[model samples]
Target: MLIEVRNIFFSYLPRTPFQVRALEGVSLTITQGESIGIVGRTGCGKSTLVQHFNGLLIPEEGQVLVEGVDTRVKGEALKAIRRKVGLVFQYPEDQFFEENVFQEIAFAPKNMGVEGKELEERVRWAMEMVGLDFATLRDKSPFELSGGQMRRVAIASILSMQPEVLVLDEPTAGLDPQGKRLILGKLRKLREEHALTLVIVSHSMEDLAQIVDRIVIMDRGKIAFDGPIRVAFSQGDFVKQFGIFPPVVSQVASLLRSRGFEINPGVLTPAELAEEIRVKILEKKEREHAGSKRGNWSVRPS
Candidate 1:
């Protein structure tokens, strides 16, 4: 397993009046090269769980293992776990400190002691991976770019470290439709090309439906569901209670089914729903045509 969380429990401030249990007995296992989506209402411990994966938060009770190594282990081993798991927090731009885009992206590699030719190559490759042209944007200030570009630069910074697992927390929190599409596309490409184990935390079921293979739904600091996206989304009542909206296509398919159509409920993308509707319409039209040709169609005379 790339990540393993067993009966984990964590609190913001233990043994205090303000103490809040952020996670309780949450267990999950993520294999290498798998894409997982974490979905839930606010304050459901999605952020807390991902933090454990990278050693950002140590478990107060239970264990978090990355690549079969316990994160609680001290020194170089813990540091190595951090290097293997690159976390991009919500609004990653807030983490940026470098003046120029090039420096911002290269910060991670530089910190890891990569220098000279190798460091330059990694920076350039990371920038290109995120669709930023080094020649065109490297000299520009990261703060000056649009919100989407800034997010990409932050991701590139993590990529420079070349982590095995990429954990993104609300990666597309604030963006227009086009911006969301572009960022999602870049993530998809990264998963395909690099086979990076990705754990995305988002409230957008529609976005996760389009990209992730598995969905982990968290509610009230506990995992409610962990399964394929289709299965997770099918529990309409459970999903609704968690304040998550099913993907548009799933809702549309449900409505069609209620209207006596045979549309499958597993359709997640607009493209898949469109194709199913088209096929159904075409099949209906073909049946009508056949009946008309056979003189089996009847009409009432006025």
Candidate 2:
């Protein structure tokens, strides 16, 4: 397992008047090279849970284990663990102090003792990974770029460190369609090229449906569903009970099925739904043709 979150119970402001339980006995296991999506409503502990994967928030009761080592360790050990798990928050802050893009991207690795050609090479590699040209963007202030570009630079800062597992919280939040695609597309390519394990927390099932293999639905500080995306979306009504709507395609498929069509229940994409609907249409045509032939058999020569 790449990460194991074992029966963790965590709360905010413990022993204080504002105490709130963020996670209660939450447990999840992520294997290497697996793409997983965690979805839930606002304040449902989705972000809190993922923070534990990188030692950002230690569980008050149980523990989080990354690569078989405890995340509760401090100093050099914790830093080493964090290097393996790179986390990008929902809305990454704008880089202000860095003179330019190269410095911003190099900040982390440089602190880790990377310098000169190696540091420059890492910065360039990270920029290219996010589809940014180092030569053009290196000297530009991140604040001067568009919102999407700034977000990409923030992601590049994390990528420059070359973590084994990538954790993103609402990666597509607050973006237009094009911006969301730009980011998600880069992530898809990175997963293919580097075989990086990804743990994505988002409310967009439509987007997650396209890339993630598994879905983990959280509710009220606990996991409500943990299974393959197909299985989880197949039971549309069941998931709906927990306030989760299936992907748009799945909802359409379910409606068609209710109306006597044979659309697959777990259809996750428009293409898949269209293909199944076409098959159903062909079957209907075949049945009508057979009925016509049967009627003619009972009629005269005409």
Candidate 3:
């Protein structure tokens, strides 16, 4: 396993009145090259769970291991695990501090002791990974770029480490349709070209549908559903019980099914739903045409 979480439990503000349980008996295994989506309603522990992947949050009870090394390790060992699992927070652009795009992206790798031409190459490659033009944006200040561009820069900063797994929380949040598309498209390409493992935490089922193959639904600080994306969203009622709206496409498919249309509720994408509707309509037309022919009256008596 690339990452293993063995019956972990965690809480905030431990031993205090404000303490709140965030994760409970959470066990999961992530394989290399797997793309998984972690989702739930607010306060369901999605973010808390991923934080353990990179050794950022050591479990209070159980253990979290990345590449078989426990997260409880400190110093160089923990730092190495972090370099292997890069996490991009929601609104990551808000964390930017460097004066220039290149500096912002180079910071992490530089702190790791990379320098000279090697550092430059890592920065350039990371920029290209996120669809940013290194030649044009390298010298520009991150604050001066558009929201989408700044977000890309933030992601590049992590990518510069060349991590094996990229975990993102609400990667497409607060962006227009075009911006969301740009970020998601780049992610899809990154996964394909580099075989990068992606673990995305998002409330947007539609966005998750476009990227992840598997879906893990969290509820009340526990795993509620874990299965293929189509299977997880197949039952609209079941998914809604956990306070998640099925993907818009899945909802539409369910609506059509209720109205006597033979559409699959497991449909995840708009394109898939459209094709299902088209096939159903064509089948209906064929049946009607055949029925009309059978009902025709013969003129042989004349």
Candidate 4:
């Protein structure tokens, strides 16, 4: 396993009157080259859980291991884990502190002792990976860019670290449809070309459906559902209990089934749902044609 969480339990303000439990006996394992989505209602520990993946937060009990090394380790060991797992938080652009785009992306790799031409190349590659034009935007201040551009710059900064696993929280939040599509497209391409394991935390089921092969649904600080994306969304009613609606395609597919249409369950994408509907229509027509032929054969001397 690339990452393993062994029954971790965590809470805020420990031993205090206002303490709030954020995770309870939660265990999960993530493998290399897997794209997983974490979805849940607000305050359900989705963010808190992923924070442990990179050692940002240590559980009060149980263990979180990255490559079999305990996350609680100090110094270089933790830094190595951070480098291997890059996390882009929600509204990550708000954390930008560099004067220019190039500097912003170069910060991580530069801190890792990359310098001169090698650092520049890393920054350029990272920008390219996120669909940013290095030549046009390198010298520009990240704060001066549009919201979508800034988000891309933030992601590129993490990509510059050359992490084997990339974790993002609400990577597509607050963008227009076009911007969302651009970011998601870049992410899909990054997975295919770089083979980076991705763990995305998002409320948008539509976005998750397009990108992740597996879905991990959280509820009240615990994992409520863990399974294939298709299977998770197929249980529309069950998932709804966690305040999550299946993607539009899956909802439509379910509606069709409810109306006695032969649409299949587990339709995650629009294309898949459309294909199912088409097949069902064809089957209906074929059946009708066969019935007509039978009627004609049954007509004896009429």
- Find the number of clashing residue pairs for candidate 1: 0
Residue 31 of candidate 2: its Cα lDDT?
Answer: 93
Residue 9 displacement in candidate 3 (angstroms): 0.6
Candidate 1 lDDT by residue in tens digits, 252-287? 888889899999778888898999999999998997
Best by the TM-score measure: 4
Q: List the pairs of residues colliding in candidate 1.
A: none
lDDT of 3 by residue, 1-302 (tens): 99999999999999999999999999999999999999999999999999999988989999998999999999999999999999999899999999999999999999999999999999999999899999999999999999889889999999999999999999989888888999999999999989999999998888999999999999989999988999888787888998878777888888888999889877999999989989998998898788678775522343
Give the number of the best model, judged by lDDT. Answer: 4
After superposition, candidate 3 runs with Cα above 4 Å error: 286-302
Candidate lDDT (C-alpha), each: 0.90, 0.90, 0.93, 0.94
The TM-score that candidate 3 achieves is: 0.93
Estimate the overall C-alpha local distance difference test score of candidate 2: 0.90
TM-score, candidate 4, is: 0.96
Cα misplacement distance, residue 116 of candidate 4 (Å): 1.3
lDDT of 3 at 63: 93
Model 3 Cα displacement at 232 (Å)?
1.9
